[model samples]
Target: MESTSPMRLSFEIRQMSPQQKLPSPDVGGMSRSARVMALLGLQYTRPFHRDALFLFFFALGPAVWLSMTVLFALQPSPRHALWSPVFLSVALWQPLCEELLFRGLIQGHLLESMPKQKTWLGLSISNLLTSCLFSLAHLANHSVSWSLLVFLPSLCFGFMRDRFGSVYPSILLHVFYNGGYFLLIGSATR
Candidate 1:
């Protein structure tokens, strides 16, 4: 069995073949910053149509925003504006870390480990599994109804990740989602 060393694993995109073109999780030999940048580069998947229209429509469209609007109406946050540490973190850091872990790591992991063609109702089993796990991960942070509400968006985020063949789009969507909700919450509260 032949295994490439860490030094050889983190080569530039142009150095790899089309099949191996997708960036692997190999941050080997790279500086900490470079490794982070690479991991967040959104180059770690197969070729995709990569249309902004789809990203907007499917993940960040009117329907999604409306759902968020409804949620805000039902459960407007107690917090005030974006100044609060918690609100700021939720609008920014939370999405980044969550998407990085869920879409970038977990969903990607399912894609790598699960059967490619195994799907239900036109959704990949991996996507479904990732969505379920994503929802469950938030169980402690929210009530059962809220976690169930979260599951729907989890599916959307996972689909965005899969459709774009990268996590960047989903991350952006997550940011927009939280930011919008919080913005509404702030305004509605004050």
Candidate 2:
């Protein structure tokens, strides 16, 4: 004998268990656009803190260069005050932009789909690619020497980003590296 009532059928169906809970996706595994937005948000929220490292890098860079210049005054080269403006604008500005693009945005997105080991490998590959692009971006400078210098340092920046888990250190390191290079060049030229 079977019950044919509509209410009885509804009751039977209700007896089934609810579905199991699935694991939540990691928040860090956001899309590139989302990560960019997040980075921008971070910058906006803590503009001072974010910019502090850069400012420190900027100030310290010149000082370090001056010291090295004084110490290595024996090296003869073309002295040019014009390079000061170029160093601040090009070297500092470019590295900051590149860090935001590569480490903050692109790396954040790629890390989403990757396992731990794969994430490291992906980061390495992405860093290399990004660094190459960065180096190539200097094509207008039109010097193989400049390109070669940029390539290795850009890789070092990527490596720093990977190790520190934040682009801030790398940004600082980059500014230092560039600043040091300019200071050395400027001192040598003098």
Candidate 3:
């Protein structure tokens, strides 16, 4: 019988062809920031069809907004004016910034460190934590009740990020949600 030294075994493994080597979870020695970027889905996934995505969300957006409109006894703000700077900012800018931070950075970091398979009610652990934080962030400007109300939509936004593996879908949904809410139910001061 022959005994192999650790150094000799290591050398032998290095000599193997790439195909012969087992895959590694080390991400090819990527830097921490690079790995995080990859986790943030900097690269779009294969089979990302733009038209399909838009069509589905276009249908989904109206249904969701309409449901909320019917469920809540909300009335339009007396000062409501279309295409105002405040409305544009709330509908467009806020969604872009919030999605990039919550889904892109925070959730991306959590996904990288936590067990991806762990979930509650079909939502990933990373997503749940991120959604909770997203809702909490609203407390700075909104009432406790309103902050709590924000949680469900935050979850939906986070779900889109997880589902698409990109922040764009979340931003898109968020824009729709905000735009609809402001147009249909939100106060002018928002």
lDDT of 3 by residue, 96-141 (tens): 8898899888987786675433555546667889999998999999
Question: Backbone clashes in each candidate structure, one number apiece?
Answer: 0, 1, 0
TM-score, candidate 1, is 0.65
lDDT of 2 by residue, 169-189 (tens): 677677666556554565343
Name the runs in model 3 displaced over 4 angstroms.
Answer: 1-36, 46-80
Q: Cα lDDT of model 3 overall?
A: 0.66
Per-residue lDDT of model 1, residues 1-190, tens digit only: 3232222333222233334222345667888876555444455444333554444544554455566555556445554545688777877899989998888777777766543334444355666888898888888767666677778778777766765557876777788787766665453422
Would you estimate the TM-scores of all the predictions?
A: 0.65, 0.51, 0.68
Error of 1 at 13 (Å): 34
TM-score of the candidate numbered 2?
0.51
- Candidate 1: regions farther than 4 A off: 1-41, 44-53, 56-62, 65-80, 187-190
Clashes of 1: 0
lDDT of all the models against the reference? 0.62, 0.51, 0.66
Which prediction has the highest lDDT against the true structure?
A: 3
Order candidates by lDDT, high to low: 3, 1, 2
